[model samples]
Target: MPRITVAEQAGVGLDGAPRPSEDVVLVRPDAVIVLDGATSLRPELPSGGWYAHRLAGQLAEELAAHPDAALPDLLAGAIGTLAAAAGLTPGHSPSSTVALLRWTADRVDALVLGDSPVVAFGPDGPRVLADDRLAAVPRRGGGYRDRLRSGTGYGAGHLRALRAGGAAMDRLRNREGGFWIAEADPRAGHRARTARWPRSAVREVLMTTDGVSCAVDDYGIFPDWPAVLRHSVDKGLLSVLEMVRAAERTDPHGIRWPRPKPHDDQALVHVDFTEIPK
Candidate 1:
């Protein structure tokens, strides 16, 4: 089996309270599972982190029972099981992004939903697996990002704006031509983007939630994917997380990146296939 390393941290809210991270990371004998719970805008329902933890728990059980199952099929079944338990329709439930990778002696399989992503370092360098549908969805003009840009920080008015934007986004969730996430709808699992690679072609693979990936993609911490991977190998995934947090600290008011939070829950897994025994 390949050598594996995992790192995770809960994000702080705007108020700097120490809240539970909504991200989950599971390292199985043959797979890696990463889930990022959606941020909850409402006060009544269970938080997105709660749902993500539940979904990750369910997936852990299912994957252990069927190690050889198709990635999407397994996801769909687990989702259906969760939906039945909740007795809720697709849009009515809390949601999360999913990034899963399973491997055998011959090949490796991956699935991506929401913004969570995977990066594989192969002979040709780095290749990315991501779900961009959520980014493609139309968004409100004066929402969170706009508020951050205008120096509102995260306040009551910012929360209101966030909710209004979330309401608009909720309408598009799980709908045709809109983005798909792991919610009450099982079909969204089937809609996840999937990919495969020859085991021999891949040297190392990294799975990360949007919190970490946004640093590489949006924050421009590194020039490219190769640099990101190299840094992780040189220092560690925890160091990367620290670097991201440090970057956020420099711009406490969100004038630079204009994100929803100063720090997001960071979850990452690194698999070193090269470290496998001969």
Candidate 2:
């Protein structure tokens, strides 16, 4: 059996608030898991981390027990578990983006629920696996949520906004939009992004929340991913925390940007998939 190497990090953004946890994993044969929680300013919804922890723990178990289950089925099961564990009425409860990558000798299977992204790079180039509505929003000025809130609620108007959101997402993020996981709402619909990996010449794999993905614009598709992954491996979760701290140093609401988006929490998990045994 080939061994697997994994790393994760969480940090406060330039705004000085805690970022949400956004990475989750269920590595089979060699299990590795990362879960990220979304941070919210609303005092009424304080359990983003709690929700992520519970969902990741339970989902990891379910995936471990039945590694062969369908991706959608697995997600449905996880969602049910989350709703029950958090006592969330489908109407209430903080929702999160979920991404899982499980691989075997010949295939790599991935699943994504929200805007959090999953990206893969290899000898060929970069390819995106799972993308969500949030991917479309302009990340430069906190347009991701700003655009979401500007739309009509969850009906047809909301779906239109989401579609419009993607069109608005500029692929200028350095390496282009390789796959990355992002935060999302459950009511957002079934348009999940998924893929099976090709082992030949594959070099790297990354699963990150919007915080890191948003920064990808700074690096492009492959960006400084290898360094970022290595940093996470060396510094552990705190490495990501530091990145969030760096983003926080900018002050989202500072005079630098005139009007600024509310500071949001962030988490990122970077892995050298090639480093994981095939």
Candidate 3:
């Protein structure tokens, strides 16, 4: 069997208040899952953290019951289960990004929805699997962080503006020429990006939510994904998160690295397949 390690941390809110992290990490004998809940703009509805926790639990159950099921099918089934249990309406409920890895005796499979990432380290080097369509969507008010930092009295206004912007983005989701996410719609599972590789071709694998990925994608703290993976294996995964926090501390404002929040919930899972017997 392959060896697996995971690490996670809750991030502070804009007001410097700590909240429960919305990131979820699951490691099973045959699969690994990492999920990041989309931040909620509306307080009346269930929080993204609530949704992510439920979804991850359901996915783990579904995968355990049907270990041989295809990745897409497993996701679809889990989404349906969650929607029914939560009684959420499509386009109006909380959602999350998902990254999944599953393996058999001969091959490994990967699936990604939204911005969460999965990287496979093989003889050819690192191959990153992510969905970047969210970046293409146009945001209003100079983006979420700008509005939040616009002035002292703009906090509520910023959230309201974000709610409006999110509504528009919702329309573009789960469709052609737009992005897809795991909201109330199980069909989004069909739209996820997936890849397959022979077991021999994979030496190690890494799965992370955008929180941890921001270190590479947003801050440029590490030169490349390979460096991030090596660091995680050499040190602890939490050390990578500490590095991100150190960078954030240096740039307290959005001037250096523009983002909605200073800190984000982080979750990561590392798997070493090289030691598994063939």
lDDT of each: 0.87, 0.52, 0.84
Query: Residue 234 CA error for candidate 2 (Å)?
Result: 12
Q: How many residue pairs clash in each candidate at the backbone level?
A: 0, 40, 0
Task: Report the C-alpha lDDT of model 1 over 1-278, residue by residue, as the tens digit.
Answer: 79898888889864657799999988788888899998877677677888888888889888999988889988998889988998757777889999999999899999998999989999988889999998888776777898888888877777777788888888999988989999999998899999999999999999999889978788899887788778889998899899888898999878788877778999988899999756
**Residue-wise lDDT of candidate 2 within 1-278, one digit each (tens)?**
33344444544432434554434444555333445554433347645676676777777777877788866566667666656665665424555567776665666667776556666667766667655445454355433345434432234443344334433432321123422222222322234566777656455667766556655543232255555555556676456555654654564433332212233345554546555454
Give the winner by lDDT: 1 or 3: 1
lDDT of 3 by residue, 1-278 (tens): 79888889898664557998988887778898899988887678888888988998999999999988888899999998899988988888999999999998899999999899999999999989988888776666665656545542325655566667777887887777888899889998888889999999999998988878988888899989999998998898999989998998886655566665668889888899977646
Candidate 2 residue 223 C-alpha distance from true site, Å: 5.4
At residue 15, what lDDT does model 1 achieve? Answer: 62
Best by TM-score: 1
Candidate 2 lands at a TM-score of 0.63
